[model samples]
Target: MSDKTESVSTLENAMQLMIQTFHKYSGDEGDKYTLSRAELKVMLTTELGNYLGNAQDKNAVDKVMADLDANGDGEVDFTEFIILVGALTVACNDFFLEYNEKGEKKK
Candidate 1:
């Protein structure tokens, strides 16, 4: 995370984007600090539809919410959201490495 006084690097900008994205969908009908199930559904479908691949499916959303709601409070907090993003980032990195390895082997 970048301190307010420091210049924003690319990583810092990405952090800021994550924060912005969270708040963008967090406070509609429920707590301003967390995401309700409905809010989560909209956020997932609208922001990560491609990456999540079936976010429109009700059962998928329920499963995701259950997995992410660490406290079982029926909502997802920022920490849980960050964990999801981090896992996805790791998965994408693995995919990229595999793709590059395949390309190298073909050369």
Candidate 2:
């Protein structure tokens, strides 16, 4: 999972990227397996800067943490992180579909 990218399928590569990205932030300040609020904030702002333009806003980070901390543990686990990413992916897909449709209409 570390460096053997040649053998991985596209979906597997995506999964590995998710795992790597989560760990990259999870171990920053608190539990190595979960993301504290601060760690989550850093991860969102740093890793998703383009998608989440104002992720640096304190309120936005707080809202994301509150929504993702499903266990009420004040930290986000891998599953929770995946949920956020999956939702965002779906949203992105929908946006692109709509944009494509609009472009076709204008053509």
Candidate 3:
């Protein structure tokens, strides 16, 4: 298979592994703790940093927290965390693939 195809397959496998790991650690669907989307976004901001090159901006983090916390709760649950993870994974993969493609073209 071509390199691009291999990279895509690898990313898919990695994402599956992540889901399985989260489930295993947190418990099955019924028993799992679910986080609100807002809570998850806030956690991501703190943990992963804003990918928009503005990690130093506390306002960005606060904004994400505000947007995700629809219920005005203080924390996120597992469901929200998983959704944020999925979104971040896709964005990161796209960025990596594009960066790699550019590097390859240059070489």
TM-score, prediction 1: 0.92
TM-scores for the candidates: 0.92, 0.92, 0.48
Instruction: Return the candidate ranking by TM-score, descending.
Output: 1, 2, 3
- After superposition on all C-alphas, the RMSD of every candidate to the true structure, in Å, is 3.1, 2.2, 8.4
Please say which candidate is ahead in TM-score: 1 or 3. Answer: 1
- Across 1-107, the per-residue lDDT of candidate 2 in tens digits comes to 57875787899989999999999999888789999999999999998999989998999999999999888999999999999999999999999999999999999
In model 2, which runs have C-alpha deviations exceeding 4 angstroms?
1-6
**Global lDDT of each candidate:** 0.94, 0.94, 0.58
Q: Give the alpha carbon lDDT tens digit for every residue of 46-97 in model 1.
A: 9899899999999999999999999999989999999999998999999999
Per-residue lDDT of model 3, residues 8-76, tens digit only: 578798777766654444443333554333434344445576564564566765665565555666444
* Candidate 1 residue-wise lDDT at 18: 97
Model 1, position 85: C-alpha lDDT score:
91
